[model samples]
Target: MIKTNTKKICIVVSSLGVGGAERSSALLSEMLFDLDFDVHIVSVLDKIDYPYKGKLLNLGKLKAEDDSKMGRFKRLKIFKNYLKAHKFDYVIDNRTRIGLFKELIVSKWIYNAKNTIYCVRSYNTDMYIYPSKFFAKLLYGSAYKIVSVSKAIAEKLNNEFGFKNLEVIHNQVAIDAEELLVKKTIKDNYILFFGRLNDDIKNISLLLEAYSKSKLPHNSVKLKILGNGKDKMMLKQKSDTLGLSNHVEFLEFLVNPYPFVEAAFFTVLTSRFEGFPRALVESLSVGTPVISVDCKSGPNEIIVNEKNGLLVENHNIEALTNAMNRMLEDKNLYLQCKSNAQKSIEKFSKSTIGQQWKTILK
Candidate 1:
């Protein structure tokens, strides 16, 4: 009798950065490892921001310390050789495929289409890059499955690229009540907003504008913005100009931000779009209500208006301000929302999502 080898999986990502998509990939890798599968990760970049339970193959060292492009082709050959040696049963790719033509060529030439799973983790991804729509079919048509993190993203991809094998698998959020409810740095009653401080996509300007217009600033309730990004200085300048310098506090990115989320009266997100907003689900998991923009995707799926949290019109400053004021001042409503938060997000628990991936892989 011939013995079959234990299934080996490889998760390909840009990097294990602190972004939502990177964290989700790491979490999935962790889950696969816990299930007794041989798991490996291939990160294009060297940065490892999130924790993972896999053997890492960092390609960041391919370039010299000076970031020279001299060994680009040599690195590609090395990467292909590495994949050939491991012979992964399934390569679940989680990187953004927008403009990665060279990488796409590597994937196309080296990876078996029947054993690959391409993941699209952003809403309307084709719109992000100029030629993505035109190249979508060419890039992902060979993959066995194309997974999207939300129904919105899946539908968008299908409409734009006509991918017949597209699947929607929502990301999971796990919260240890004891860990999240533990002591936080700030002991004050405050509303929270945490993500990369990018104005164009995250539109934190909408958040700051809402906070400035809200009544909570006058009632001793503070607004805490967490996470650092390219627009930090610009956002800080805006806050100063809005006279919110005193009321709004910008906090640096914390690896563990759940404690802050748990301690907040409620968390807020004002993004233009999302594949799946992990922060909102995470906030709910930590027993904190959220107020978020009803963006292109994600939020509408998670937030049942007036149930677990409040959903405001996308980029509507007045509506967001009113929602924030309600979350702060409306004690009874706030309590009701808080009480309903955890239960509403049970579907997004790690075990439930892990089972989905297990089924698909099997």
Candidate 2:
């Protein structure tokens, strides 16, 4: 059902998997579709797991990799032809464009500045691993606009790249209190931690240590760790070593984790760094208060200390433990925070974030 008068938009990303950036792109595409825009997705890897709107253009199918040196160029040619044929009003690129040569070629020649919007999801330093700072500065300095998901990210990008057209458009998630209330969930009470089991980034070990030290376990409170990864065994072993094998449980990733989220007393995130932690927002959306480490980019922006959740110092196990104890002992504060959670996150609603995209794209 394409509208004759609608403007066509193409969202470009590495893949539409379960990552934060992928989810953001999917949510934005859905919202834009609702607003009568014809949306299209360009996934480099052809890996799409998120629900989205519009046609999908998988450049990876070009088998460019099978061709070696000239494959990427051939794929780019095919993509260019598609863009020319569709005459897309805008191409919002959400992929990390840190590979200077390829990204510069794609951003500069494949897509013109006026028709493309570059997105920066992570902190400035983490955006690209290769090339020098000067190269990153030059690469994004030429875009029509650079979109950052959080103010902290935006500031870091500005301080480093100083892009002339950097814009802050926070990532969004849907929040429906009535709907969440109706969803069937487990009757057991537990504190939840959901997301990848990556210890280096997610720091599940920190969470385990904090929980083991907290007084909640003494009160028969269970800590449930959800999501799967390579570090699952190591984290489980750590839990065992800490004598929390009985109290801390490790669970596999669930497609619909909202029911578990709803059933929790509260949720916790102990990430080393984040683009924008969707877990915190999702937890708050379902009326479950959160306690997160005030990490590099996301937690501080979302969690108002003692308001909707508590923000502990980054990498401080003692502080994290204290925060968990506080949430358990301070019943009045926890109730107040839970009561205010849903209303506080309304600004991040689909409609609001969609409107921001509309303004930026226009």
Candidate 3:
């Protein structure tokens, strides 16, 4: 049974599907609900896949039904009405705020600034605060709080925008008890890279290059790249060109990728930048050590070099290749990392992060 509470909170998100930030929002809703707050979710998009605990206001469904300009106005009116009706104690805005005019209207006319919290979930600040830095400051200046998912993001915002109300909260992972208990059997020896297949940000090409150079291919270890994106075909072609057609395997995104992570030799990340890389943390939580390029704002915080996992310098193809080779050849080092993996990420557990949110909400 859910306990009742007077402090009502609403989470506004772009979608609750297929992305790290969206997953975090879904987890936040469940956390707030479990913390006895009357949690409500307002997903702007209609792609709800993750399990969440809250009353939903799916504006995307409404948009899908009526996509006309008039329909947009109607949705806006409905959104304003819903906020007015609920009188929520706090509204956490987790959507990308790139449209300056649209955000200005929403901030000035719709949302109550003093009770609203804005979240910045990417290293690319332009996605969350666009047009101009001065405008972003003016826009979010009076917000109850501006929460950055990593300390690097928070520091960047502070340095660039001089915003005083900033908080750093790392994304939490939902470690399943059943998953932990299940005995994972490795069917094949493959290194894994899961998440969006975007090349611009994820830098998957770098991963492919590093994998091709690594000694794992000679040892008959395959490279499994999972998830879908616009660059899927391109990445596949690159794999073929690298003569890795037989060695590299592409799998579609899975709702629960824990089994894949658990069964892998280890997971690898080669992103250029990240707000907080969930794949690395998720991999570690399942007792799988990871090899990641020490990208901006995330990997340094999560990985201890040669401890829980290997953290190579960003964009260094040779360094990553060497790390991968070491992980495969160094049995003692790999075992040590695997043993430390699950315990290293205990700070990112749901309950620990939930308590942090509870304090922020209060």
Best by lDDT: 3
Candidate 1: misplaced stretches above 4 Å?
A: 1-5, 64-67, 127-134, 176-182
Candidate 3 lDDT tens digits, 264-345: 9999999888999999999999889999998887899999888899999899999999999999889999999999998999
The TM-score measured for candidate 1 stands at: 0.94
**Shift of residue 185 alpha carbon in model 1, Å:** 4.3
The full ranking of all candidates by lDDT, starting with the best, is 3, 1, 2
Worst 10 residues of 1 by lDDT: 126-135
Regions of candidate 2 where Cα sits further than 4 Å from its true position: 61-67, 128-133, 175-185
User: TM-scores for all candidates?
Assistant: 0.94, 0.93, 0.97
Give lDDT per model, in order: 0.83, 0.82, 0.90
Alpha carbon lDDT at 112, candidate 2: 74
Error of 3 at 290 (Å): 0.6
* Candidates 2 and 3 compared by lDDT, better number: 3
Best to worst by TM-score, what's the order?
A: 3, 1, 2
Q: Which structure among the candidates has the greatest TM-score?
A: 3
Candidate 2 lDDT over residue span 130-196, tens digit each: 2366766566566688888888988887676566788888888874445465576466669999987
